[model samples]
Target: MKLRISHETTYGYDQPIRNLVQSLRLTPSIFEGQKTHDWRIEIPGGIRGPGFRDGAGDWVEGWTLRGPAEEVSVRISGHVETRDTAGVLRGHREMIHPLAYLRSTHATAPDKALREAAMSLETTGDHLELAHGLSALIAAAIAFRPGVTETHTTAAEAFALGQGVCQDHAHALITVARLRELPARYVSGYLHSTADGQAHEAAHAWAEIHVGNLGWVGFDAANRCCPDERYVRLGSGLDASDAAPIRGVAMGTGAERLAIRVQVEEMEQ
Candidate 1:
């Protein structure tokens, strides 16, 4: 299947500022189950972009702006071809080691509930089965509540509320898996559902556990299934902050408000 994606981010500030820097992880990566035919990223103003690959081998882009401007806008558009491997991403290649995913920044530390969930995780024989079971548990456990959790919400908080968006769900799942000594990574991307159907909050996130034979296998705890062709993987890291599609700081007098738009669709070629 062929997919087309368009994403736009706009920041409106009350006053003009001097400097701004942002890290962007908006480019899709090539894995075992998916292939990248073409992709690109664009910035309108004083922004520079390429591809930023972290120490963990996750590819992203860091942007910086230094000028007397109040508002900034960034756009990313691309197209790719994908296929479903029955949720099995066999031969998936990752440059970084699995243990690399365990390390987390101060902002993404797991909370009490997340720690408890981690302690409760008993290793089943099959990793795939464990992932599936966890996915079902999360779907059944949590209700999709908007504005309940912010970008910085911890896994414990999300688990306690039992209601969160994709970011929260992915964080909870990762904490649980990490406690069991499993190497799990955070995935950021776009989910292409029918426009007339229920709308998505914005961007999407999922979890991928590293299996010995399979390498990296993706599981969508929010949707309770593995990633399919409708899911276009952009980048991945240890937590949501690490893999955020757009993150940056700008120098301004008042404050800056950001608006984001993402549209993903299936296209016939």
Candidate 2:
């Protein structure tokens, strides 16, 4: 399948900022499952800095804006051809060891409820089955409801609330997977909506677990399935903050407000 994506993020400030620096992970992953065709990141009047691929095999690009300006915009447009690998991440080069993901970040730390949820699942000593079971359990546990949680909502808090968006499901899944001693990380990406007419928010989030010989396999509890051709992976990290598509700092005390617009659609081949 071929997919086209357009994303724009705008930042507004009450007062002009002295300077702004941002690290972007907006490019799609280079793996067996997907191939990039045309991709570009544009920041009007911003200086582009050097970019590099990290140990986790995701491209990180830097940008700077010397601003006495009240607004900054980042726009990304791209097309990618994707194949179904049945959620298995293959041919992606990375230097990090799977065990490294076992360590929990603040956003994905397991609490009593999460730990209990992980422990209650029946396991057959089969890593693949265990992973799927966990994904299903999480999907059943949490109802997918937007506007119920914020970006900083922790996995434990979302679990207790029993409702959240994809980010919450991804964080909660990662937390529970770690509690089960499985290496897991958060995945940030875009997903084309299914034909069922279910509406989704701008971007998407999922959990990837290391299943012995399978490397990293994606599980999206929010959608109750593994990633397929509809998914375009961008990056992976211990949690959402670490894998954020855009992370930056504005050098002034000016209050900032943000607005984002994203569209992911299936394109005819």
lDDT of each: 0.74, 0.93
Could you give candidate 2's per-residue lDDT for residues 74-144 as a string of tens digits?
99998999999999999999999999999999999788889889999887799889999999999999999
Candidate 1, 68: how far from true, in Å?
A: 1.3
- Can you give the TM-score per candidate against the true fold? 0.88, 0.98
Q: Residue 252: error of model 2 in Å?
A: 1.4
Residue pairs clashing in model 1 are: 52-60
Error of 2 at 49 (Å): 0.4
List, residue by residue over 1-269, the lDDT tens digit for candidate 1.
Answer: 78778888888888887888887777777666566665767666666756656655557677888778788888887787877775565554456778887775554477676666556646567876676666666677677777888878777777888999888878878877776667888888877762235655467888888766776778887887788877778778788877777777787787888898888777887
For candidate 1, the C-alpha RMSD (Å) to the true structure equals 2.7
Cα error, candidate 2, residue 98 (Å): 0.4
Clash totals, every prediction: 1, 0
Worst 10 residues of 1 by lDDT: 193-202
> Candidate 2, which segments miss by more than 4 Å at Cα?
195-201
